[model samples]
Target: MGRNTRKRRTPLAAKVVAGAAALAVGGGGLVWANFHASAHEEGPAHHRTRSAAAQVATIDCPDVGQQLSGVPDRARGEVDGELATMDSQITEAYQRLATTRRAQAGDPRFVQNTILGPLKDRRKAIIDRIQLEIDRAGGRADDNLDQLAGCQGRPAEQPQNGDGQNGDGQDGGGQDDGQNQDGGQNQDDNGNGAAGPVADDFIDINDVEPNSRDSENGLAANGDGGSTGTFTTDCGVNENNLFNSDNLIAAPGVDNGAHHVHDYVGNQDNDAFSSDEDLANADTSCRNQGDRSTYYWPVLRLQDGTEEFDANELGGGAEGNVGRILKPAQAELKFVGNQQGDVVAMPKFLRIITGDAKSFTNGDANANSSWSCTGFEDRQVTDKYPLCPEGSQVVRTSNFQSCWDGQNIDSANHRDHMAFVQEDGGCPNGFQAIPQLQVRLVYDIPTPTVENGQVRNPYAVDSFPEQLHKPITDHNDFINVMDEDLMNEVVDCINSGEDCQ
Candidate 1:
């Protein structure tokens, strides 16, 4: 299937220019072009106009191959030079901002302090742009030159098969003279048939019976001595033809937990609670609570069975089974990914504590199960421990902590409790356990802030002052403060002056 099917295009002059630029920048050290010209004669040879021929003669064109060859090295050099210039400028600007900041620390007139803000942001943007340009030009030039080299022919591949010669000094395909006597069967020199149809080794299907001993029916009859017509085989059945409801039967011993009917099939154990009894009890318990959170605790059994808690009882109400206690040593926490974060439905928070000692106050202790107390006062301690906090009715595990908020529980203090109990082992089993909690946080695009309003040079003495309220710096700020137009103008000037050295 090998074929030369690719279409080719005529190489353009612009490509040549680009190739040359690539080669110079990638291979040569030169960053800029140098053109030499003599000064024109005063008064243009006594005001005499030159002819078109003279003008053409005066114009000089460089060798295409030479120019293309130097492009890679030249491009690389230019990129490096530009980066260096940008870096120096950024550094200088940063220093100026820093100096201004130190001198005008509290001056109301210099309200927008330049030490660590907008100016620094601008410097960062310029540096970033310069770096991007350098990488693009240098990489393009190198790639072009490599491609050009491949386009030129390299070497040819060799054939692998060996020459043919029999040990008897005769051609490998040659026949013996004695074998050609009759040639009725077209025999070879070795007396073997060269051509003609031969009899098949096995009997034909037409000779065998349609329901004979070799068929599936035959095999079944022979195995059990039963009539083949009595049974029907599934020879023609396919996956698509199988009906979901056709062969279905009520599972055996479903009432005594011998078998289970899955949720999709309209079984009682369709939800977190194993049976309708548990769900009814839980629903009744929460009915009179009037806007309080409720949970269904799934208690797995030893024989792959499950039990559920009465929600109303768990919440200590009179409508149903209340004050239903769970033994901590026997109950393990369950984490449902999608259901964890719903406040009205699950009403639980999930958090994960890191094993790093630096993440907790009891750094010296084993932190594998410890919780975090960071931002406990503000109820925002979930940053370090992403799971539910303690004292908020959390379900404890070997590696994670979960909690439930009942009666306006302080989420932060709960987090603190989880962290403390995990490290110190103060929380005990049978201490009024709450349903295990799980929570997840989702984020959108980042918010804009003053620091990001402009690029900042960290080392500058007179950079823009960072905004007090915001943490992140953004793209718009960098553009507004940096002189992008001026930078572009410089680039254009250099590009237009092709004759400049």
Candidate 2:
């Protein structure tokens, strides 16, 4: 009966303990499930979705390179043909330059033409090459567009799991599909990446020369085919150096053997006697026919005969003799004869009167009237004749005699035939007493000799040898018109005053 009671207690205890253990296990499983579900909902899966959505936000229809693949290859072929033609033409130009040099040997003009002319042709060739490349690239541009359009037509795929199942389990995750599509697109983009089609229209190839030289590590040559020694290298470097310097020196010299001695005929000098004879002949031909006698005027002197009129005395006169002897009283007389035996009067005046003789006329109406003594009647005349004081007036001889006393004798009345005289104590109203006048004959009268029944003047007689008087036919006109005093007044006004008042 005691054992039955204990067994009942043990069964009850086992049931109670088993119930507690089941409850604990169930609660812990619930907690674990909740935590794992929350973690899955909040992590990388959410981030991946967001990232994928952002990537597809705005769809670019055609990528840069894909647009170029749609063009046909035939157009590219035409561009390639054009490039070939350009290359041929440039090659031919260079060959022609070489041929020209061979034909002309060392001619400088030919050498210059060969070098510079080919350079221009090569420049054109380079431009043509660049243009052809651009054309070929452009031909391929349409192909890119077709490829881009084809790519856009397909739908984007989603990411997949490693088991190759789609997220929806029916269409696979589409991620593997998308990656496959993207890989092909990337390859097409790379294949179509021909930059020449997209290059600027004015892309000049000359700029590439420096780039090419850099690629070769700067080992280069100058234009004239000489090594630059600086490491840079380019296509035209050696050619440029050769043409510019080295080739020029290698060119041959020109032949100049056609020169003749007759070219220097006039450069030779004749003997001295021959030159003198030619000069003498020229002088004889230019000689005048008249005045072979060489008449010289008498040399003037002071009354005391102390000083003779030398060339130095050409313009000197007594202080009171203002107009008595003309200013510039004497000049060397060289009579150039005309066709006849007489010297021309007007021409003689031109040769002797170095100063302005027209100023001596002073616009007097009488000066224009006549050459005789009658014209002198209206003009101012000097008393004591030509001898007058500075700024003095001359009166008629009748007036002079009227004012004269017999003792004083009115010495101012002195006159010669045509002009007034300054002699014998004749002094003008404003002047001091007159100085004396005298003459010293220069040319001796030729001794009469009977030659061929004719009397002739000796041509070789030595006379005074100092005569220097110049002829003055219009003496009254010169004296009455301008005087030294008036000239001084005009000169003074010009020097110290304004323009003529």
Candidate 3:
């Protein structure tokens, strides 16, 4: 039987306030809280408080790989290998998050932006592979891990493509579609630089879990299976925009900080850097939607000189020593929730990020997150990229959690204020759970064209800038700019067991 047990999490001893410094063992230095309150999200940062009275922030994960025996016949060996890799990565991701929480006791936003968000994104590949292999083996894995991995049942299954050319790439996309395709071609041979890695269009979301089988009627999975309901929207024509250099935040002063732009979506006039007020007041392409939440992330390229993404140094690469950055295509932001209870309006300034910018930096090679052909989302062999069947385009699917600690909307780590939705689709006790939001991005990227020339990763996720046109570096963020009324509507919809557009 596959089951998980929650450990007794101890509460915090007391709350800390901003500017009121505390002491450390044998150390006497002020605990700095470097937070600037945004107009809409004004309040003391979570670093100055805790989720509850004396409750230390903690994340729990079940013992993975413990149910390998459940893996069926033919796929057993592959499933076992993938599960082991998955279990190790899952453990590291969670342990790393826990360690981060422990280390950055004062700043919760740092924990959220720095730990929780990145952990979820980095774990995407493992989660997908596990699901695929488990299904191939004819078994079900731990539901919690599946959800946490943000693994949706998948778009719909596809027959194995590419003649099985995974990584042994002696042939990625084996179709030579790299050289030609039906208008949706995503290759770069202009000579400025070679095209990046090639990927498939999609993997069946239904193969791993069936939508009809969702535990609750209105509740949809938060990517993976769960008792949560979900809906997505494109902020009208304002779906994509360029960032203002003045507001830029990542990749410190490079090229006199003149370039290195990012692609944005959500609020209009959003720049590289900005405050909650600027984001809220600015116009949005999200026409009718009353809730004025702002969402944006880095943009990818098509490398054919058509799309933007022309920055000299993309948003990441903090560790340096790399030629190209890896990324995924598309970043969808939507509201999802419990079928029975409505999610309380998220606090005005709840800042959230879903992936780490510096994730592929230095030695932190992302194990499996990357772009690929349709029906081959789980394959990791970089070079053996699969070729999609006709009518399919490459895409990246990302998800973000929606539960928040009632008292603290903004934590030092950004995550302390929020937690993953529980297996029951409810927020944890005392924590204010909001509707889970999911981000799904689709790209026009065709098959890989620039074979050995500029291709860097043969076993990696989508890399960036150099390979911008290749649909790499997919990430997302959001700030709850909704006032009381609109938020209440969101809550009402969820509590009533309904579907939202």
Q: Please tell me which predicted candidate would have the highest lDDT against the true structure.
A: 3
Question: Going through the candidates in order, what is the number of backbone clashes in each?
Answer: 68, 37, 73
The positional error of residue 128 in candidate 2, measured at the CA in angstroms, is 4.4
Estimate TM-scores for all models: 0.14, 0.12, 0.46
Return model 1's CA RMSD, one decimal. Answer: 40.8
Put down candidate 3 lDDT per residue, 348-420, tens digits, no spaces: 7676655433232111121112334355445322213333445665644445656677775443223455565
**Model 3: number of backbone collisions:** 73
- Assess candidate 3 and give its lDDT: 0.37
lDDT of 2 at 277: 25
Q: Assess candidate 1 and give its lDDT.
A: 0.19
State the C-alpha lDDT per candidate: 0.19, 0.18, 0.37
lDDT tens digits, residues 1-501, model 2?
A: 000011111223223322321210111011111111101122321200011211110111111111122223344333323322322232233223312322333343442344334434443444344344545655322222222121110111221111211111111111121221211221111010110001111111212222221211001101122111111101111111110000000010101000000000000111111222222222111122221111111111111111212111111111000011111121111111111111111111000101111111111211111100111223322101121123322121110110111132111101111111122223224332111111111211212232332211111100100100101111110001112343333234322322221
- The candidate maximizing TM-score is 3
